[model samples]
Target: MHFELGFVLLFSIATAVAIAARYFKFPYTVALVVAGLTLGVVHAFEPPHLTKDLLFAILLPGLIFEAAFHVEFRKFWKNKLAIHALAIPGVVAAVGVTALILSPVVGGLDSVRDFGFIHALVFASVIVSTDPIAVVGLFKALGAPKRLAILVEGESLLNDGTAVVLFTLIVAVAGGAHFTVGGATMDFIRVAGVGALIGGGIGFAISQVIQRVDDAMVEITLTVIAAYGSFVVAEHFHYSGVIATVVAGMLCGNWAASTSMSPSTRVAVESFWEYLAFALNSVVFLLIGLEVQLGSLLASWRPILLAYVAVVAGRAVVVYGVSALLRFTPERMPWSWSAVLTWSGLRGAISMVLVLGLPEGFAHRELLVNMTFGVVVLSIIVQGLTMAPLLRRLGVSGLKDVYQEKYELARGRVGAIHAALTALEALRRTRDIPADVVEQLERDYQQKAAAAEQELSALKQQTNRFHEEEHQEGVRRMLIVEKDALLKAYQRGVIGKEAFEHLVAELDERLAKVKDPEGHVPLEQSSPSLPDAA
Candidate 1:
């Protein structure tokens, strides 16, 4: 009953938060934290009995499996550079700087354990890993340019593995194990290599399994197994669990998307993961928000604040400095990417989880936990809330957000048709098809295809309208739905407000183009381009 009640409370709060976020334009993370904190305080005396282990056990696999099962490997390969920068070195820099800058406050705080620099660095290490899951809602809601969003999200996902591996290494060192920077580098590389190999291996095996089975249930179940199993196996071997999941998801999501899995199975798997990710994210962040005791933090606010300032400064340096060494092009990577990377690099659930997971009675554990919570809160509320607006100010907008939206909608329709056709063929092999019935089936397919085309046409028209500077009536009618989707996604924690507002502007511009009609180009024909979101 308690278990059931917990989920119910979670679902209800998530649903409410989703609705509220749509209207408020506050960071979804911020709103959720505030909402959760309010509820947690109210129920502080009788807090929900959600164990960290069950959460890792049940939700982790489902969430990971779903993401891996649908990732577009080809697309991931295209933006691998940005993904690497943000995921690897970015994490290292953030951790190093955060620990160094925040040491005085953490060490000086009278109540918390006094910490040596190494321990402080461990604190930085744990806290620097960003929780992409917490902020994915913002990405999808605003229709951030798919590539940019992909980089942020993909980096976050992969970096979790990197962070996990690094966390392990640091924890070992902090435990009085001998450590050298060179050994750390080798350990990091080896873990990453092993993780990739294992995840890719799982993806290949799953792909084969998918091809041999026509059962949607079987295929979907296999996908679920693939996600969690891969992570578990990777972690068991002390490899990068997150990277394994990312690889597995990319392989299954893209390679086998049109090839192996039935459409029904894909839908079931996607739906399951989507809900699972949402639920898991809710529990994780909600706990982070609720677990925070204000008094514990306010007592040492000075050093925490100074540490935060230094961390941000470090982020700025990392962003600018790293970009110089990397192969990121000004045209492709854009300066805006750097700016958003610095600001949107909010750390939350991961930090909280790491802090809580540290060994009980560990030296400086209390101080570390408190400071970790402090930085996590600041990142989520301060950085998360303002990420979108900051992106707009940097002249980066979610203009091509429609491409992914339209593409997803179209892909779904196409996938369904393909699956249905496969089923129909299978049925035909087993039974005689009457001439009239065959004709009827063909006609039915035509109707379905026609309907899909009509929907695509409408979407394309809306897309075209957004690109145009003038007006058209037909475009305006289409925009009502588009705008609503953007708004709903933002509200639902599927995208960020900055992303939403930027896309909304584009949609409005398209509506204007339709109204004017003369300068308009058809959405289908016009290649999508990135514009100054501001």
Candidate 2:
């Protein structure tokens, strides 16, 4: 297919799938894959192949960067222990366990050929990276805890790099290249570390540039440069490009975007990345469906089913094992989360691209490819469809009530109208427009704001969670005000350095509790009244 025609077809299919999925209340990405599968079975107009080059050079960086960009570093760091455990050693363990389980089983299968421990290891490495896009979206919609979502997302970001590194090493060893356990560990460290440095340097540079520029377009462009540039540079030096992009995205988002960009510029940059993520997800999921051949999948159904079971079992062992180890730590989660974590390990485009990238001369390449594709499809369809019910069954669905949605909409309207009124007042002061017209506009906005507030109040009465959330927000703002005042006092020499540090430290402790009140006092138990600085 011509490049232009292919994209149009892909996007058209994506749009149709999106609309239909939303209307039918289905998972959008899964729906896209299903659509692509139907089209593939029918041999619909040829679509562009989702090759390794396309994924690494384009899709992977964008998707990874977008996820990393929105991830608040504070939230990520709070769960750092669990995230790292699940991502690094947990992944490596899962890979080995999967191979151990599958190697014995597959060696006995009559249909499978030349697939042993080494081959199983390669397949395990390919499928171990969890693609959390679908599950994360579901978590947000179902009102899962922010920390839970962060753990899932944060782990995925790091594991993608880890799994890719592991896959490369295993592939080399399988290809008869000399390898040792210590040598492999060193290689992983060197690649991952260099990639982090490269990404962090690029991200810091981009952030510095953003601080000097006010234009939203330029800042957005710089973020794009940071995402792709970090990946390209790291890859040029044969380091982990996935890790590089992820680190660059985090730095740009948390450090640069927060410290430098104006609110409007930040919004613009975020909105741009959001849309890019959606578009990339749409095309990639669709391509995943299109890439599969039903005939081949059916022929290898037995091995695929076995491989899928082994993959799930491997994930179960790793997640539960980590949860057990964390049981005594501050980062420990409920037993239920282990189950959710295991189920959320859906394979995605990265696995597909990795398997496809295998050399044609590689032994058992076709079998490996079929097994990988089969597991990816099964995971998406089976696990994706059941995740919501799992969340509900486990009592982790925090709040799916419509009242919260109504409250949020009303609250947003009030804030937007207030901003508009503030802008109008500034214009009136400058005499940029007639005072009477400005006065009339201000009156209109004030009325709308009043109505929005009334609606918000009505909704709040219907849900205690909304009220608690508001109380938390109010307390946070007051704490921030206190911190700001203390900083000003110290700068102006109105307070001794010791006094300032002590006061600020107390305020910061309070702020941290407010931000992550997991073990702190429940919001509903406290007074909803805003704190008085005096």
Please, what are the lDDT tens digits per residue for candidate 2 over residues 46-130?
Answer: 8899998899988999999999999999878868889999999999999999999999888789977667899999999999999
In the range 172-222, model 1's lDDT, one tens digit per residue, is: 898889999999999999999999999999988998988998887787777
Poorly placed runs, candidate 2 (over 4 Å): 411-453, 456-534
Candidate 1 has an lDDT of 0.70
Cα TM-score per model: 0.74, 0.85
Model 2 deviation from the true structure expressed as Cα RMSD, one decimal place: 5.5
Shift in Å, residue 110, candidate 1? 7.6
Instruction: Give the range where candidate 2 is weakest over 10 consecutive residues by summed lDDT.
Output: 520-529
Global lDDT scores for all candidate models? 0.70, 0.89
What's model 2's TM-score?
0.85
